[model samples]
Target: MLKRFVVLLLCLLLLAGCDQPIKSGELEKVGLLVPETINDQVWGTKGYKGMLKIQSHFNVDVYYKEDMNSEMIVERAVEEFAQKGVNLIFGHGNEYAVYFNHLSEKYPDIHFVSFNGDAQNENTTSLNFEGYAMGFFGGMVASHMSKTKRVGIIAAYEWQPEVEGFYEGALFEDNEVKVEIEYVGHWDDDQGAILYLDKMIDEGADVIYPAGDGYNVPIIEKVKEHGLYAIGYISDQADLGETTVLTSTVQHVDKLYEVVAEEFDNGKLKAGNLYYDFSDDVITLGEFSSDVDKEFENEIHKHIEVYRETGKLPNE
Candidate 1:
């Protein structure tokens, strides 16, 4: 395994280190780098759909590489796409932003797009969603539905804006509500997330938010098996069960991909960090489950409307 790693690393380094000038226009060819398989039913799948959307509507060829778990693999994907004259590459997760920034100077002609991070180079663009609003509303649902007045969130990291949003939103809805947060160390650790879920349930949590993209589905399934409620994350998960999910905090990343394609088409695409929120319709709350109280759901909608119109959340 080490020998293979060394060989792959050396090959990719050679490919990327070559002083190849642009063989194509800035946006003529597009590439997508996904951290996991495209069939994961959440983040990666959304990313793949976004790539397809760009291909269908824009006058560009699209390429994708999945299961990007290592620095070597990432470099290999980028180098492979670069060889194909892909001057524009989209890293489907924030995990790629730093790597993109690192490669920015080396590949000055390549433009990189990724999520929720700072871009240090003129060739990199960081896309952020106003996740706080959705998290806050999700918190409200958890608090409202919890007979135990305790909720939990299994997040991959503390830097995620939605974690803070959910914490504060729960308290805002009910000051007595207790919120538990545990990180599974990374995005795809389903077993670790399950352990955290078990701990939360034992600690009196009646509702939980499984916020890790790859592991959330299994965690929600566990929540259902435990006869608890959950505030779904990333995708609309109300279909999981009628009473299992309260409301899903949806991030329509596919639509954001279309936005990027449109920007490229219109010659407005550039390097920088850009944020989208409820007003842009990028971050949203999905349909309320049948178990969600009608009155509480109405209140949540009112809060969303006020925030959309005035750019102020209730806690603000």
Candidate 2:
């Protein structure tokens, strides 16, 4: 009778252990917050596409709120996702980093991710886009395709790292290259971008590069109207003007999202900073126009090879 009692007690203990909650690496739900609408076809769209890829791959429940520019909206969205028991939350831009830092500690069970920003807390992780390298690629294409040896860039702001990188890359290609710069003070200032583009064209800038978010559209239109060569940024604008547009620098955000999701599933997601660049195949150049010669294409590939091997730009 005592032996029977001992066996029953052991079975009861095993059942109690099975009832205890176990934390696994399996992800169920995810949330995304974007500052602009998903239809922007650049920054916001790329993020939306990444979320969709994540959803398709993991079959996880994903929710997102676009055009969330205000702090209150961001906070509320984060709170709602937490309430909904999301395993992870992603802020598509640096604008949401502050909120992620504040809420991450309160919701220790959930992971907070910030794109294009630095991590501020233990529960938060960040992925920074290498804008400078992207600019370098654009400058290389522009310099190689310029006929007048005068390449111009119309940027949203002065002293931006990406703009500086473009100038450096142009100079690297040809020491005698004349590079012009103009700052429009805002990313979406169409009037200012057009005025500066005119000034650049008048100054003998045959190859123009626009390094702003929404400013590329107007500049590309002007480039087509003027029959000048232009290099695109962010998304592929070659379809915008087939012959006039040389190529574009593209950000492969879907790859980054895949890495994050795989890491989370493997229980390797940690709070820290993650850097991605040309070496990681995160920042890349889009399809080159047929106008680009074989020799120029070979030269561009050679530089890319050097960057891949050394993990540094030519001018770095």
Candidate 3:
């Protein structure tokens, strides 16, 4: 009778464990907080893609909130996720970094991660990609394709790393090339992009690189109107310009998440800010769709290969 009682209690214990909210021991419930709708395809969408990659590789129960525009909305979303007892939370944008760090402190037991993290917190880990490498590659494309040797860059913001990197890359590739920069102030401002595009075209810029999100539409139209080549970001948007797009700087956030997920699962979550630079292969350049000169391609490939291996480009 005692033996039967022990067996029954053990079975109940197992069942109780199985019924727990987050999987016991190793398995965890993961929550991803995105700044915008998953269709944004610029930043928020990229993070969602990362979340999907993480889910596919690991045994994790994932939850996400989309189209969160305001900080209050983001805070509420994080609180809601906390109430659901998520073990890990991914705040998908740099703007959400401080909020995520704040929430991580509030809920001390949970692990928090921010993409493009700028905050420093004990319980929070931030991941940022090296945009300079991407910019440099883009610069090379612009330098090679520009008939006037004059390139224009329309940025979402001056503070964004990609903007800084773009200039740095362009200068590194060719300081003699005339590069004009125009900040659109916001990611969604099409009017701002149009204003810059008009100015650049009037100034005889044969090539333009649109770094802003939906704001690229006006720039694309301008590129068509002026019959000029343009570089694209986020997506390989060459087709959108009738083959005028030279190349794109692609951020594989999904692949990045896959790396993070595997590391966390293996108990390799490092503390503090984690920066993925050019050497880490975190940022990559898309294929040049233009009829690139064979000699220029070879030269660019050689330089890229050297940079990838040495983590430092020659002369720049």
- RMSD values for the candidates in order, in angstroms, are 12.8, 4.1, 3.8
Per-residue lDDT of 142-201 in model 2, one digit per residue for the tens?
887788999999998775567888888888888788999989887668899999898888
TM agreement with the true structure for every prediction: 0.89, 0.86, 0.85
Once fitted onto the true fold, the runs of candidate 2 whose alpha carbons sit more than 4 angstroms away are 1-24, 157-159
Best by TM-score: 1
In what order do the candidates fall by lDDT, top score first?
1, 2, 3
Error of 1 at 212 (Å): 0.8
- The local distance difference test score of model 2 is 0.82
Per-residue accuracy of model 3 over 1-316 as CA lDDT, tens digit each: 9999999999999999988876324437788877666776566677787777767767667899987667789878878877887777887777667886667778877777886666577768888877767777787778778778788999987766776666666666677778999987787788878888889888988888888766775687679777898877866666666467777777777777777777776667776889886567666666666567767767777877888888776456
| CA lDDT, every model vs. true structure | 0.89, 0.82, 0.76
Candidate 1 error regions (>4 Å): 1-26
